[model samples]
Target: MSMDPVETFRIEAAELLEQVEQGLLDLTHRLTDKDLVDAVFRGLHTLKGSGAMFGFDDLAAFTHHCETAFDRVRKGEVPATVELVSAVLSARDHMRSLVEDEVTQTHRDAGAGLLADLRRAVESAQGKSSAPAPVDPAPVAATQDAPAPAAQAGWKLWFSLPANAMTNGSNPLALLAELGELGEMHVEADTSSVPPLDGLKPADLYVAWTVTLRTDQPRSAIDDVFIFVMDDMQLRIESLSAETEPRAPAEEIVAEAPSIAASADAPAAPSSIAPRAAAEPVAGSGDAKHGKSSESVRVPAERLDELMDRVGELVIAQSRLSQLASASTDLQLRSVSEEIERLSGELRDTMMVLRMVPVATLFGRFRRLVHDLARETGKAIELVTEGESTEVDKTVIERLADPLVHLVRNSIDHGLELPADREAAGKPRTGQIRLSARQAGGEVIINITDDGRGIDRERVRAKAVASGLLEADQQVGDHELLQFIFHPGFSTAQKVTNLSGRGVGMDVVKRTIESLRGTIDLTSTPGKGSEISLRIPLTVAIIDGLLVRVGDGRYVIPLAAVEECLELSLEDDLRSRGRSFISLRDKLVPFLRLRELFRTGTKPDPHQKIVVISTGSERVGLVVDQIIGDHQTVIKSMSKLHAAVNTFSGATILGDGTVALILDVGHLVAAGQQQEAQLRAAG
Candidate 1:
């Protein structure tokens, strides 16, 4: 099927914009880095040229203006001053809206304002570069265009695009046409590699090209033509000068006639010289070959999700087969079932890896966020990211974006103190916000930490009392007090602000995380800054869980959270009847009797097992009837009737066609903690 050129351009343009943004952000720290400056300019140049080619005239025009501003920086006529960087950043965003057909009056006005600022910055820098004594431009031009130098400057380019390049949306003809625009050029095709008519692939490009060009444009220009096709394509470019070795008769004849003007309209030019032996293709901006792309194929995200769904079904079917096989006396059937089970397990693991993406894609956007936030708050804030390569489920990453934004914004606005305040407190004038992620067991833990004034406990307590969330003399631990921040319409800010502290964001963040079957915890030291950590499961679709029976009901506890299981002797159970706590290695670990918690009046088994599970540092034991071995739990959402149950996060279908509830470790752990607090208060 023929791909749409406009859609192809949009995808390519989006990637170029990302490069442009990254380059501009990098330049903010190292303004004098010529490579960074050139990188940014080249990205803008390609986007403009490609945009115009694909019929996005407005985008092409807008990007050209920004490209011109960066061109000045590239030529050393203007420094990449802070003002210029900021202006161009804004322009870059406007260019995106234009490309996406999302431009509005506001965008137009913002673009105008940014362009105005950019012009002023460029003019200011130009005044400095041009301040030196003016030299005669006529002599400089004559020196630049001297015949000897011009003759030595031209390049011969040979390009053989990938066979499927056209199918992948590359236009070789358009590329050759662009080369014609570069300078005086002759182009010819080499058809030696083309197969016979019976064997030809309609979508494949079988011919190669050789071009002799005379231009002052750098080799980078030639490199840009094959930017989108650089992967696995053969391209060679060599300097052409008087001293260069003369070509053979056939090669000379092939390279001589059909100047770019002569073959401009020819669809089938004659064969040219063979490609210069093994000259590696020079890639354009951000086209560095990391070897991964050569073996990769692009698949739509929905297709991946669909594949996961099918895999989940296969796992369920395999489970049913295993259950039936174990009951039958057929030896061959049992062996086949075990083999199928093994294969299904392997497939599940492979699917998990496919769904996992590096957290770096999530972290990259925060550079711009921090840049803008620093300016908005009038305080120097540096964002440091760690463990960006840690992989997590793509769904988890997408859902985490908004909550992380709220937390990071809160850290800057309410957690981090101003420069003067921080300095007065004997801290660095520039506050630091660090975002770090790592996979622990089956969960990905993400922490947003800021080194500034931490949460004010006394003030929070006072506000809690005033707001009637607590009694005036209510006593609570620091950790319990922190939970009040997640309460709906809760805030202790002295005054409301536009960005936050209007009693809005934090509760929503908590709700969103909980909906994803995750937990968030906040820790703060009065003067040592604050950190909020979110622990989320790696994937929600299927999980390895330990199935256990509590009374007559079955429950699935995430195996990732299980520490160990210990048999609770009747003597110890009877001795600790009222006070449900056990001493494990001299540590008093709390336990909850599931039969009592669930009010399942049925008598428990003589020998009760305590399943010790943990979330982070808190450990709690659940007393259950029996341990039913591990099962692959495909989670299904609870209906509206059971949505309010805090003890279970979701339900899963067992192999026996019975429904089992998945335990919510966060809720259970919190309950255990509260029970311990109550016992202490009574004592």
Candidate 2:
């Protein structure tokens, strides 16, 4: 099915908004960066143009104001300041709402208020610059998207598009019309490349243009006309000397044959080289805006997801085939099945690579969040990020966003102190928040660390006691005590604030993480800030699992979590009966008996096997009846009736079509740790 242009525009606009936001955030750090200023202006300009073309009038109109503000900054008429960045950041959000078809009166009012702040900031900068340079011609404030007066000099521009330009959806005529809007213009086409009637390719662009423009607009304005085709198109622009005539024909200087200038009144020539006017334009020439390659295609996320589901089914079918091939006596059938197994495995790997997206896309939104939080709390917060290139499953990235937002907010609101307080405490006035991601084994570990006053244990304990969440005389470890923060409606704040203090954030964060089959760890020091680490699987849809047996049932342990498999001697089992601990590499690792945990009500295998799995620094051994080799497991969520079960995360189809439960490694490891604690207490 073909994609709708409007939907495509909305998607592209969403991306453009990210660019604008990122540029604005970067500008905050380096206010005087001309390149950053120009980058932001160009993003806004393209958004305005594309939005207007896509019939998003409100979005275009709103974005135009921001574009105009940045345009002045581009021309040194105004300065890029925090206030301007903050105002534009707000404007960016409104643009997002419009793109998503969520525009309302509230958005309109907020847009107006933001625009007013933008105007004041621009006017304030202009008032300052007006005196420093008395002859500045730009207005202190302009409204209704007034065009800036073109630069006072004339310019000559020549551009030749690629042969497939028209086929790519770019209309050269629309570009000419935009040029016309700049100022007095004389446009001529060089149709020298046009083939004869018998040789013509109707969609091929065989013409070039030499435009003599007398406008007060900057060179960037003319550059914007060809921005869509700038990558491969040959373009040249030069300032016209005072003595040179702007309208001179191109053949006057060239040694080759004189160029033919097609007149606007010229009778319509061959359809192949027909020109389009800017007013009545065609769709874009398939120009991948913002430096993206035209060779790439935009597939709906749903389509990719559907493809993944099919691949998952194929993996299961392959598993069943592998089981059949092993049992078959026919050599030919076995050979064919083996070949299919290899191909299916390769296809599954390829499919997984397609689903992996860099974590950078997930981290991009936090810059804006940090900026707003800084303003709302009246604190100076700096966000530093690392390991952005680490890739995780697309689904994982999507689900993680909300949880990360809550953690960041909690850090800024309750963790970070005011600038004066930070200064008095012998720390830098600006509190720093570092968000980093990395791949650890089969999981992605994301850490949100801050340089702020850490969690106040005394306050937390008092709040817990007052709320009856804990007994005053009851002793608790720091790790267990911290769990109180995730209790719904729990807060230690002295007073309620707009951003926080009513509680209800950390608990949601915890729930979301647990839903993804992930775990969160929190650590803090009284004076030295806090850190929250989230550990989640790299991909949730499919996994390589080590199939094992316990009693009469089977289970699949995530192979990535599996370190090694070895037989547990009967003597060792009896020796460590109560402790359930194994000594490996001089370290004591806890072990869990799967048969006993599942209550299988069957005798244990004489020679049981131990599967060692580790998550970060923690390791646990699972003693099973037998190691049934490896299998490709397509994870299927457990039914709602079993949703509350903690030992098993999901179930998968086995080689023989039986339902094999997928073990929840994180939960098993935690259970092992708790068992050790109980054993120590008994001792």
Candidate 3:
């Protein structure tokens, strides 16, 4: 991968934007939650700096405005109002759109709308509520719920450059240009710490600034200006109110409220809260007022994939060396082979870590989803997420978002009963959805569950039969009937609504899960809610694989799916000739011959091998001609021509430069179950 610094910044900026959006959404739940406020402020602040670093002048300028508003709230000059939160939330989306517009060479509204909204939100929180309210009634509650912030003294700003700030090429002048937006400013450069010009180090920053700003805007506006330089202490601030009244459209009413400008007993309140306004820049911060932080390092996704590709090659080279050493009597070759194998194994372990990402990133999106869904459905839904720190391959986590969204939406639309209906049924009015994830046995399990109206088996059966998906005389179990929901054109809604029931989304979820080589389980209990679960391999692009030969062609089975491998004995082979079944631990497990399935013409060997593979609850044995041992498979997606080739997930290159298809264990197990069904019918 090219080490393009610009691309690196782009990815980081996007992540920060998401964090800001989440913080904005969370504000509604915990209006006084200092952490969310700081989090949102920190995200916006970092975004502004990073945007400027990448020459995104407009982005940097716009985000600076938001950072300021959050800053005031943090310093206690203002409180978190629903109106303020909603305004910032909308502005956050606009900022993302702006970033994309810049990248795509499209029209840039120059962040004008977002900037205006941000200013309005800040102003309203400062006791001026008339800032550009939407014509629609959606935001009406938010406006009424927000209490204007208490007035403070004029804005006070302090900045301490990171000791080596100048060496890093950060310009203090830029911080100054934006701070000018907050009315009159008196900047006092702290040169007392500076050494004489002769004794001075050119790259060392010996100067800091303390600026006094006189402005009608809230103190947050000033804090926003210094968002980028915050950590370096290049900026610290305390705001106070001037004796004269600042005129606002809501000034006449805001004047009616007694203002809390300054308290002689608490001078540090404004300043301490000022720094704390930005979100958790600190790592592992339990104290809400003071956040945890560490220096951040950014890496490119392409670089990670490039590293994985190299590791794959190293694995193949080591495999060839291992084979050569096994066949040759040369001592030197054998020694080199052992050394290479050890090094490659260690490198692969390191590469896995590099490719891993915390699941918290994925979980963050649900906060907003739940919030919007609650607003739309007029249902009180509290989403509880667990195991947020679970880690998975970045690619796996990315593809799982859409399916999870649909599942949660389905739970809200049908699984969750209306509030009044729930209450009438002797249940709590508020519905709860639990999203949990954990790594188990080389795969990750994600569960979406709701405590609402459970799936109605009768309704499902009726829909299946009406849609010609089930026989009128069929007696499918409740769990089996639930699976029918994922069928194309299968829906059980009595009346179609905006959320669901057009017979769409579920099939797409099925298609996507299968594409990722993941399995979905539908479990339901009448009046006890339903749980839709997905079991996904940790990484789709790379897997630890067991390479084997069935005929002349080889296949790779995911190492995670291999339960056990056994050699076929004459007694066991003859006992199950017509039907393929292996007695493992006194339990009969069905087996499939891959050679016969592929229609490969080959004579049966004297002895064969059976590899036990499974997905979720089903178990199947794959009979092959030979055991080829373990290989690190670099998964390559099949071309569009092979997209419908459900039997195989993808193809990987072998050590001999030949391609071997990676078998999809879930698909094969299902096929085996179908075969068992056919045999039962014939019997």
Candidate 4:
């Protein structure tokens, strides 16, 4: 999709933020880096201009104050200092909040404090610099015929208003007047479009004008003059090859075009641009120069979701066609089906790209988190991030934020050691926390590792046993004991401060990850700190499924979880209802009977099949009447109406218009665990 002006601003704003943050950090190290100072000033200048144009007035106003202060520094009048950089850093965050306002996200407490600090800096700097020169007004010239466009000295613009210009409330006079604000300019009115009195529509535009403006602004500045009427009025603004105007304060110039908009920052012209009967043309200030135009259109996020839903439907329809083709003997129909399948696959890939976003958006948050934690805990800590460009589904990114925050906080509060204690142990005073992301197989792996004193296995084991999460007499490996920390209400910290230790956050992290159908692995060494890695699927929207016919109903087992399919004789199937076990590769694996579990009453086919699936370490085979081959399944959430039903994650439709339920592997795994627990208790 082509980016509109708003999107353009967003892209530019994002880069500006990166520059501002990096500049702030570098300034923290070298306060006198002139390049960094200029870089920051440029970023602020662009942000202020773009924000104001896009209707972010509050942001523009706040940033304008900041930009003015930075501009002073760029001019070498203000010295770079820690307090100055720190103030700007804080202002950068406030600017972010303002930009989010463009997207209408919630962030409050606008930059009042930042503004005060900026003004203080500006006033202080001014005290150390030469007095600023005053701005000169436009000098009415009598060289209208003596000048030769100043020999490429400035811009000469020629623009015409539509026929009904004056009657339509566009005071062409004011537009010309605003033109003069840039510099000395001469205007000639054309009334050719204005018909005779008998043929005129009083309200219709019927006038045009040609003006030579001498200003430093690019052609874009001239376009701003008629921006409000650009699309409707056949307005064409071009550079004048040459201009010879009498530089005189002529009353005739205003008399000829006594009906248009007022000049920006200049005296009101005889002709009002607003065409409001020679009255005030400006309701607000003319400082905006020209009206802002956006390159991108603002589309609500919900509309994109709707588009994705339609695309999902199209994919499912294509899946059905593919199914029908593989079964049919007609060559032509089969060929068409194959083509449709290929096209649909390509389309789906494109849609996937639209939904994918880099994990860097998530990683950017930790800078602030780590910075705050360092200040709070008074520990020397550094945060390092890697693989920021690794892409993940948007939903996954949203869900990953909370858990990541908790992990980083825990590392700062409990995992890292105090600087003095570290020096005593001959370790560097600064603790390092590394957050990295990488794509491994079908999952994205995010690891948050700290180089502080690692998790004390002994303390964890003691906490697990004492908290009743583990039995005292139970003989458990350190790995198993460490896992218990993910159990709710289980923490090993000796005491509870604001940081973590009170045994609460980790369990939520575990639960949230599991809810996303993800896994977390924890590893740590006594003196090497801890690393918690999260492995989550790239997307949860669609998957290949092994469809099976159970009795008369159809079911789909996720192909990711299914190992292989098996055929069974009637005798073997009938005899295994009470206890189903399959011999695969010389190993016996337990299985579930779909007929009995789904409570299907009809008789199974004489020849049946078993679909073997596994979740984590447990493997289970499902007995069905027949295998329905592989099908592309679009996951449709079991509506809030059916959300409580645990056996199935969602439902899908087949080629012949049959509905099949997609099994929830996580649920099945839990069910298997429950059965095992019961059996062991009985024994």
Mind giving the per-residue lDDT tens digits that candidate 1 earns over 1-683? 54467776787788899999989999999998988987898888778777877787777777878888886676555667887888889888888888887667776777777778878877776666646534433334433323244455676766666555565556788888879988999888777766699999787667778889888765555665655455456654555642255433222211221122222232221223333221212211113333445678666678889999989888888988999999999999999999999999999999999999999989998999989999998989989999999999898889999999889888999888889998999999999999999988888899999998999998888888988988888788778899999988898888887668689888899888877777899999888999999988899889889999988899999898899999997787899987999999999888999999999998888899999988767889999999998989988888899878889989888777788999988789889988988887887
What are the Cα lDDT values of the candidates?
Answer: 0.79, 0.79, 0.73, 0.69
Candidate 4 lDDT tens digits, 73-166: 6555566665677677778888887776543333334477677886676566456546552221111121232233344345544345544444
Model 2, 26: alpha-carbon shift in Å? 0.8
Q: What TM-score fits each model?
A: 0.85, 0.85, 0.76, 0.66
Q: Residue pairs in steric clash, candidate 1?
A: 185-260
Q: Give candidate 4's total backbone clashes.
A: 57
Residue 200, candidate 2: alpha-carbon lDDT: 90
Give candidate 2 misplaced runs (Cα > 4 Å): 102-107, 134-160, 163-171, 186-221, 224-229, 232-294, 466-469, 563-590, 617-619
- Candidate 2 pairs with clashing backbones: 150-216, 150-217, 151-216, 151-217, 168-285, 169-284, 169-285, 170-285
1-683: candidate 3 lDDT, tens digit per residue: 45565666666678888878877877898898988888888888778877887788877877777777886777666677887887777777767776766443332453565567767767667675344432332123223422223334356555554555543435777777777766788887766666688988776656656677766565445555555544444233443432243333221111111111211122343234332222122111112112222234456677788888888778877877788788999999899899999999899888888788888888888888888788788899989999898889898888888888888999999988888988998889999999999899788888999888888888888888988988999766555677789899888888899888899989999888878888888887666688888888888766889999988899999999899999986666778878887788998788888988988898656688999988777788998889888888888888999878889999988766789999998889888877765665566
Q: Against the true structure, candidate 4 has what lDDT?
A: 0.69
Candidate 2's TM-score? 0.85
Alpha-carbon error at 14 in model 3, in Å?
A: 3.0
